[model samples]
Target: MQIDPSATSHPALPFEYDVCVDRLPDIVTRETESAVRSGAIPTFVSTDGKTWVSYVDLFINMGQGRRLRDPASAFFVSPEAMRRISYSSDQIDAAGPDLSERNKVTLAGAKRIAATLAQLRKDLPPWPYDLRVPWSEDFDFPLAAFIKAGQLDAYPSGRCWWVRSVEATKLLPIGESFDDPASPWFVGPHGRADHAEVVRLSAAHRRHWPEIYGPALTPRVR
Candidate 1:
């Protein structure tokens, strides 16, 4: 959907904090494209709207909390928006499998949501596989399942997903799941696969302070 031009200027109850939420799906879509094109890690914002960081900054040897917090980092919103957008953009356009019938299942009440969860439980791939990095193959099904099952909320700008369980904020963890050589979850600067720079910096620190920065600070070459 087209973003409201005034969304950039105004701040409302939920969408007030960031341009990402104010613009909703549109800004997220554009930002996803930008992040991909620029070879930067996808963005992740916490449900409470209090924290955000790029995957590279969060996981790699890079110092924590160093990257900018914004939607330009995340791909789809939570699973709900992800499904709807997939239905309209991929399904309707015949570019991907059509979940038309599945999409019609309303998440209005708890019962319906539960039923949807049941269907998703059967359809989704098993864990570990489901927890793979977003850019990996077969990632969407498990992610959609998690959202429907009230395990994850990926909405841009940090608003909680509509279908998540109350305890999800505490139970479910978001972001990269595993380390893969093909698509390493944590990369060096600018999301590059090589961690040489991170290693070099750590080595330099070790050389300077042999006792202080010891083995704990050693960079893992993934």
Candidate 2:
């Protein structure tokens, strides 16, 4: 759908804010595309409309607060708007199969936005596979499963998938899952397999982290 040009100057909200409560999905859908297309940035406005980063940011990044100004502006959705998309903020990592309500809103919005943007700009990067990143034969199924679970967050940006790396202790754990390369669960920055895939396979189950990726306890070890 085409963005309504009339919405350009949001009347009521602050200059920093983009879309408001009443028109979140459509306006956000448009803005997300602009970010990927023309590079427009966004910020989540607070419930009071006085604050820049909404309470939603706290729910993401393990309450450490999101990086609002740099890297890229996160969708500045208000709590009221957040309700339109999801319910909670609990996460498996910085991002994962089940993202919080705010995150779900952001991601779903990105998929629609990016898909549309890709069509308009041929120069925009295509899917990751076309970049010659060397995928394992079995990559498709689990990756599809992950996408189906709504966990993958690498959006269609100009370069590689924009995997938003978060604090080491949060989503996408910082350390190696297994020290032994012979183990099936080994994970690191540069593994024999795809790094993101290895991380996803070994760490997607955040709630069960202690039980997973432990080679000695792994079934593969036996």
Instruction: Output the number of the lDDT-best candidate.
Output: 2
TM-scores, each model vs. reference = 0.19, 0.17
Give one digit per residue, the lDDT tens place, for model 1 in 63-155. 211232333543323422321111111111212365233222211111222232233233323321212213223343233456656556533
Residue 79 error for model 2, in Å?
23
Count of clashes, each model:
5, 7
lDDT of 2 by residue, 52-103 (tens): 2222212221111222222342433444443222213322232456555543
Q: What is the C-alpha lDDT of each candidate?
A: 0.30, 0.31
Alpha-carbon runs more than 4 Å astray in model 1 = 1-22, 25-72, 76-108, 131-222
Name the lDDT value of residue 29 in candidate 2. Answer: 46
lDDT (Cα, 0-100) at 89 in candidate 1: 16
The Cα RMSD of model 2 versus the native structure comes to 18.8
Question: How displaced is residue 145 in candidate 1, in Å?
Answer: 28
Clash pairs (backbone) in predicted model 1: 42-73, 43-73, 43-74, 78-154, 78-155
